[model samples]
Target: MDKINALGALGALAQESRLDVFRLLVKAGDNGLPAGEIAAHLNVRQNTMSTHLGILTRAGLIRRRREGRVIRYAADFNGMRGLIGFLMRDCCGGVPEIVRPLAEDFSNA
Candidate 1:
């Protein structure tokens, strides 16, 4: 993740609904949720949620697949890892201990 890409991903997550959408999709797992279902869960209008989904997609934070007549959205975990890795890349400098808790958290998750 370069600086611009990282900034785009972070910008996508800056909005409340977009953040909720991403987190909800993560919790929904790889199977994901249909567009309408996601909007309903967030108490957002489908059209509005669609806009958020588009921004997330462009940021590479989410992916979509056509499922019959509807589109299902899922969290792009690799993209997420890339973003985190980018942020943490320099954090390990002279301190493995600082990164230990993060590894442990992922392991627990």
Candidate 2:
């Protein structure tokens, strides 16, 4: 991920609702959840959730799929990985020890 794209994803997640939505989608895994279900789970208005979803999609942080009359959303794992890579590209100035713990955390996850 280039700086611009990374910044865009970061900006999209800067908002509380958007962050919650993305985290929820990530936890939902590959199956994802319909937009209405997501909204209901988050206690957000349907129209407002729709707007947040659009922003996340444009930022490459989430993906949308149409199933019949419903639209489901899921975290774009590749995009998330790219953003994380961009952030850790120069971890601890090439010191493995400093970065080892963080890597271990991800591995445990």
Candidate 3:
């Protein structure tokens, strides 16, 4: 991601509810969860959850799809990868040991 997009993604995650929602969706994987289900899971009102979802969507952190009358939201892994890539660019400085922890984490994931 570019600077603007990275900033937007970071800004979206800076909120408590939004961060919770994003993490929940990531756990949900590709199947995602319906809007109502998400709200219920987070103990948030539907309208309020909708607002959070909107912000995350605009930031490219999550994506939504229509399933008849329902809308399902899922974490956009590509967006996540983009943001991570931007942050990790030139991180290790060709030193493998410097990023070994991160590599181990991804391997488990």
Q: Rate the local accuracy (lDDT) of all candidates.
A: 0.94, 0.95, 0.95
Q: Give lDDT for model 1.
A: 0.94
Query: TM-score per candidate, in order?
Result: 0.93, 0.94, 0.92
lDDT of 3 by residue, 1-109 (tens): 8999999999999999999999999999999999999999999999999999999999999999999999999999999999988988778795788877886887688
- Tens-digit lDDT string for candidate 2 (1-109): 9999999999999999999999999999988999999999999999999999999999999999999999999999999999999999988997899898998998788
Cα lDDT tens digits for candidate 1, 1-109: 9999999999999999999999999999899999999999999998899999999999999999997899999999999989988888897683889898987887688
Of the candidates shown, which would achieve the greatest TM-score relative to the real structure? Answer: 2
Q: For each candidate, C-alpha RMSD in Å? A: 1.5, 1.3, 1.5
Q: After superposition, which runs of candidate 3 have C-alpha atoms over 4 Å from their true positions?
A: 106-109
